[model samples]
Target: MSSYKSIPVTMIETDVSYHKPSQTFRESVTLEDSALEVMTDFTRVTAISINPCASLEQARERMVSSGVQMLFVTNQYHEVMGLITVNDLNGPKPMQAVSENGGKMEDLMVRDIMTPRLKLEALDYEDISHARVGDLLETFKRMGRQHALVVEKDTSTDKQIIRGVLSTTQLSKQLGYQVQSSHMAGNIAEMAQGG
Candidate 1:
């Protein structure tokens, strides 16, 4: 979508392969050229984040302010924890309903009902480059999973740290199609070109 010259993926291996729902493929994929110098580098990151200590209302506010569907949860030390999505705030707790006949910001706390243990449940792309497009598409099949906290180990501290957040909405927008449709397209993109 730009008029400038593009980055070429002419330097990588030609045996790039991926599997899809209907079939599998092996192809050579070229990427637009950029300062990063590689397609893999282009996927570094670009997501908004929040702290787990904040109130649920505060987290929701941050997401709304940032205009991001997902909010990466972090701790006081700035280590990544888990995540919360817009969908997580939509429903009411039965206890809240019984107590006040409705839920209010005051009725909720970040830890009271948030999908707990997200700090330990985060997943990471240890081999991010190997995660094919088909795998990405399969992730979209899950419900209410727009934001995912990617975990990585901090060797220095021997602690698990949050490295990144993956928003399905952002993925869909970037690819210009439903996340579910990306499997085949991604698999195709991963294949080796005949030329």
Candidate 2:
């Protein structure tokens, strides 16, 4: 080995606030931006994903810990198999699973309650780019979905890719007001009356 001087390492101390993680974004509650501009880009924000085989309890815990309302269920190849949201967890699916499984939460998995890709509806990037915030709100209301996926084809792979996600909560925060769907409200009223 040649006798060369090694650089000495210097450690600088920083404030704890500098290393702390940031809270959920509080977007300006205004509809000045388009849906594409308001949508959460996976490229910019890391999407939380969980395995399909993970227990429902585990998935819920992960979502709570990450402060996210939804988690993507992925396969061994890391491809999105489905998606589970807080709504799914609180809905009747897990109860049905538990009742059928001798009342055990562990018996339920993300795959059991997740909305499969086949049932998931997505908007094209081109369409969304030309859409306004009001258009997205109307779509979400009509579909009664908390989140909507935006998909696009990869030029090289020719496969669909999840480009972005529009979340109602995120949109409301950005729009500075709550946007409710008449259809959803009617459905809720009907359910309440039936019950």
Best-fitting candidate, scored by TM-score: 2
Q: What's the CA RMSD of model 1 in angstroms? A: 15.3
- In terms of lDDT, model 1 sits at 0.50
Candidate 1: where is the Cα deviation over 4 Å? 1-53, 79-82, 92-105, 118-120, 142-144, 180-195
Alpha-carbon lDDT, every model: 0.50, 0.78
Query: What is the Cα-based lDDT of residue 54 in candidate 2?
Result: 91
lDDT of 2 at 112: 82
Q: Per-residue alpha-carbon lDDT of model 2 for 1-195, expressed as tens digits? A: 889999999886775333433334545633435777678777667788999989888998999988889898999888998999998999898988777766577678898889998889998989998888767766887877788898999889999999878888787667665545434434423422442
Give residue 115's error in model 2 in angstroms. 1.0
What candidate 2 gets wrong by more than 4 Å, as runs, is 1-26, 100-103, 181-195
lDDT of 1 by residue, 1-195 (tens): 879996776655789865422211123212221111112211254456676667777877887876766665667765445556676666554245336644665656555545645343444557444565435444444433554555567789988655655555545444445443323333434422311
Clashing pairs for model 2 are 29-174, 29-175, 29-176
The TM-score of predicted model 1 comes to 0.54
- What is the model-wide C-alpha lDDT for candidate 2? 0.78
